[model samples]
Target: MNPVPDLVPARMVSEFVYCKRSFYLEWVLGQFQENHEVAEGTALHRKVNAVKGSVPATSEEKPFKATSVQLSSPELGLVAKLDVLEGDGSFSIPIEFKRGAPQLGDDPVWLKDKVQVLIQALLLREAGHKCSTAYVWYDKVKRRVSVPITKEAIDWALAQVADLKKVAASHKIPKPLIDSPKCRRCSLVEMCIPDETNALDGKSAQPPRRMVATDPASRALYITTQGTYIGLSNGVVELREDRVTQEKVRLLDVSEINLYGRIEVSSTLIGACLERNIPILWFSSGGWFKGYASGAMSGNVDLRRRQVLASITGALDYAKTMIAGKIANCRTLLRRNAKIDVEPTLTELTRALARVKRCKDKQSLLGVEGIAAKAYFSAFDAMLKAEMGFTLEGRNKRPPTDPVNAMLSFLYAALAKEMTVSLLSVGFDPYQGLLHEPRFNRAALALDMMEEFRPLVVDSTVVKLVNTGVATPDKFQYRGDGCIMKPGMKKDLLRAYERRLDETIIHPVFKYRTEYRRALRLQCRLLAGVMMEDIAKYVAFTTR
Candidate 1:
């Protein structure tokens, strides 16, 4: 059980009154994602956050005003950082700054804002100053609304604090609001997933609105050249080798960094990436995923606890769902792309998918998956144009024997790495999985998530590369019977893989279009929703 915080911030109390689930996500789970509104609010607070003056300790002091005053009250179990505090040697007023205009009603100030200021007033009174009223400064309209701090208002604020404490101690996330207008512009809307959660939980019958962006503003930065040095300078990432700069990219434009083989990165850049919550993935030159370095682990302990328990008790159920989705997707891909006759293979895969539901345990599930995979891979070569000179003699890995197999192996590893990053971002333990058994140094959960995406992402990319003549016979070199992609070919493959990720497709369930990259995170979040019991079941993404 989690312990309740000793002192609740006045801001959080306001947040609780506005939306309980949002407060729980931000305060309890430590989940926060900044959007344009939040960024603008931060910018607006810049001058006010710079502490300028102090609140008078005694009533005998002369009149003074303070900006950015920190005060806490143990007796009231409250803390606040006032944007502005004014005292005239006898009475004090706490002023809170807001980015937007005041509420449109008889009371210009919102109840949440009023409660926050009242709490701040109580904190000031606890500091031995006479406080009776507070003010809310709305910067958007340059307006100030006065809120009288009455005994009744004090009681209401305290009551809210008490209720918040109970909710915190309970460790049960509050249900998201249904179809609220407040969700449209909320910075945490994507994380909270209010509409999607409510729809999945059967609380709402409407389809969820498209809250997330079609394409991310920032993208992954891949470093593949041998002996490349990555350093930070003036908010830019500079790739230097042999003391000469090869490339430069602004830090703000990079969402994550992927380093392959013998690359060196400066500690400063790594620290900056950590501060920004950007993951750095490590891979071998042959596209083998090694590991990753990240900052603090996710704070969603309850979800992970549930995941561990489910992995122990209910692994087979999840395995069936994911494997069934995988087989269905594989059949769809073969049906849509295969040039040759693949009716028999498609029928066999459909039968395998049906067998998935009747599997008794993990072993049976694996057997079903293997059968489906064999049937799917049997017709995989027919998906590509025969004139491209690429043929796959069934899927082979760990030193793929043929060029097509090598490319497929590399792209699959990249997809697995992408899933790992997505799972980590959604606060899942990547090593624990349902379909794939956890092994030492293996991201089994990522592998499990990769099942449904392999045919849609990696295999599709391989097909496009082969049919478009981007990958040719000369692009591969054989080393002791192991086919490996040459340097130029590896770069080409990465480009094609990223392009596939950027492609937008309509989600089968949501009836909305989103990029494959964003869909990865969305699927992980949906899985989390199921684990958290906000949703009835996990719905695997299967492209039509």
Candidate 2:
């Protein structure tokens, strides 16, 4: 059996929404491992929570207590966690912590929020307090948005709970009636057939794209003296006495440039792509890559591109300060959360200062030199599980170990693949990194950068899977005294991990909660400008 995570079903939903496979393997299988993203997220949250005296999100130790508490409704069979409960002056207020900004107009708030308030109201009433309205605190707004638990909301909550019970009892997962635009990030896409994809009157951007069966390796592109070419085979190209760049066959476009082979592709032609931000991922034989991009002009978007450029320069200039500010804030949060004086690692702080000085040139922390991360990861050994599966007796590096480590290694492989996707979107080389040591299987820089997002994205999600029995120990197998995942494990793991990425968490930087999955992509875009030598500064992600 796996250890239970310290969270309610809602938390699990939030986690699974980020990535389904992560949730399944961690929550169900009792398998655990940590990557840079998980570690970074964990450290940040620990720092955030450690500030307890008053919940002044900025203050490390001072937290203002939420006025009211809510207990699960025994009579109604419902569960909820309220953030703050206000007392119409006489008593404390009831409030709830939400991951995103509010979308209030005229129509009533969402059913989810209403149900949450209704439960809080019921709990307060049971506690001998009269409550009518509740506050919905958005982390993005950093203020309380008022919401009343009306008769309608209460009635809906009761009915939904009953329906939820029935749904849970059903062995098979139910497909979403309408696909939430957010479902693209849902880990359950493979399992749940949400109508949202086909329910819409027309094609929408929200539905998840089904996997394509084409082999990426089979598709190829190149430039030669003959012209530009795209194909699925190496034998198609015809070479003469000289190099391919010497001959112009048929294709025509912008300026041509040389590449891996004697052939060349037109850079000017590719430049015409509209609002281009898609990243390119180049996997190397040794886990490193050479990347290229064209999205560095985000801020300078306008007619003439000059007006936009002028303003963007100013914004990029400010981004450097933002980076400095973020590091300082992270330091402070750490002090408050862990109750330890995490003095700056850089005594001279040369690397940090250098990054800010050349903000537009450096896209991320991984690009910042002189900082070592492996030691920091070693400090977090207790929080991570040994990779399971595979065996080589007493020797670890020479061969393998328990099934868990093998699983973790596999998980890392997937992360590497995803990192390539993220880098391409922002137009960077996923392989050339600042923090990681170059090696055969190393995506060092990407690995270094991912450390910050791991806790909320992976570890916590895994805990949910195990605690809920979504993955059980029995699902694994041992052969030759080596533990390894059973045949069906990878698919199951992917299902849960996808959901976890889809889960929403209040974005620490944007102040609006977005899918953990989407956030990863967005972060890559911001780094692009820094790489293109365009931005005046780069800002590291931090609590907004």
Candidate 3:
């Protein structure tokens, strides 16, 4: 006997008919991003979504109009919360509110809309109400189109429901649409990356179209004060110190909350952040990442499962690609910024990159990476101005001996935290790594991904801070044998780091310009695509 299918929302059936890939991403993977159109549609449905009135069971009851009328059909394995249900005792009409205008031709309703309303009608019928017709209200044109609920339409809708269940159960993401007009208006276009996937797979000859904006509108909120308390007040986040309000920000404006040192957060505020899908990152006073609190793990179980398998099977090619990108970027940074002749160091890095490609196992890859890192950092002090009174003996951490290493270590910690968040957002097991060995409480996958970005983001930021005199030797203090940044210096470094993340660069592979922050998430999504076998191979981000 076949397994019983899980009940799906009627809206999902409509989505499946519209775009199978989209349905899979949303229904199966639990991914969603709101665009302007979606936002507008949400605004239009505010009243319709509110539950009011009720659907009567008997013809003897008086006529009534219900908003947000929920109905279900067990035998059909379907459920729907209809926008509006207009009913007399004997008959009922289901109405759906759409944000866009109706179709241009004789069949004025879109197939997806028709199927959606028809399914709602089917649910009403299952609930013992006679629903012969449905109405679609196009808020854009302020017109209502009537749809006849017929046997053929009901059969087609049921078939789509069955197909959608099969697709969901298959755990395979459908191939994206090729240059379809539907992509232009889709909110998930950025997540789907249709053209990019096709281009990487060699199915498309053209470069991927930049269909969606890459930069995030929301920004991370950093709370660094030692005794700050965070609380929620009427949709605003309030930061208080000593029972006095220090700052208030609208919750919608914050994407992530980064807390450093001794900070208190109210349970209400935490709940609000979780509801909005904003992660709260905890850090020690010295800028070491502790952990993060998020609402729930990403629902992309298939991707995470594949990640675990790949980790055990030894993803040698992925390891080589990441390390090669790291070595290449390190060489580029040295060549671009080194004030002294470092031709030998450059040659050694090139050799290391060559060795990375030839390595047969993770042990050899680690050896090559160590050699490349030593060669790169051997001449690291040459990149800084001598007048800045800063020098690097080599990369030192876990109590960096010098101001340069201290700053580098701090910035590296920040970069690792960023990678951790990126990996979590893409539904990967941040603790499972292809190159880095897993340790208790260590995000090895984040460490693996941050290798390529260390020189490009953190190291570059450190050099800029030193050479520009934004960070001075006076900003650091010696505690025991370890050097640490003063509180003021820590603030300045964070500001510079955020600015660097906001800086835009052209992607060497996609040939599109995007901010580093978005690029991080984009790279994570691409990595997930590789794990899911949607893309031909993993391509690490490399700068020119």
Best by TM-score: 1
**Candidate 3 lDDT, 224-318, residue by residue in tens:** 88999999999999999999999999888888899999999999999998887889999888888888898788878889889999999999999
User: Per-residue alpha-carbon lDDT of model 2 for 197-281, expressed as tens digits?
Assistant: 2322233335334421111222112222222332212222222333333333222221112122233333433443222332223
Please give, for residues 362-448, the per-residue lDDT of candidate 1 as tens digits: 988999899889878878989999989889889888899999899888888899999999888778999988778899889999999
TM-score for each candidate, following the candidate numbering: 0.98, 0.33, 0.96
Better of 1 and 3 by TM-score: 1
Regions of candidate 1 where Cα sits further than 4 Å from its true position:
213-215
Off by over 4 Å in 2: 1-400, 437-445, 479-482, 542-544
lDDT of each candidate versus the true structure? 0.88, 0.42, 0.88
Instruction: Score residue 484 of candidate 2 by CA lDDT.
Output: 55
Question: Which 10-residue span in candidate 2 carries the lowest summed lDDT?
Answer: 212-221
Residue 186 in candidate 1 has what lDDT?
A: 77
Clash counts per candidate, in order, are 0, 106, 0
Which pairs clash (backbone N, Cα, C closer than 3 Å) in model 3? none
lDDT of 3 at 436: 94
Superposed on all Cα atoms, model 1 deviates from the true structure by an RMSD in Å of: 1.4
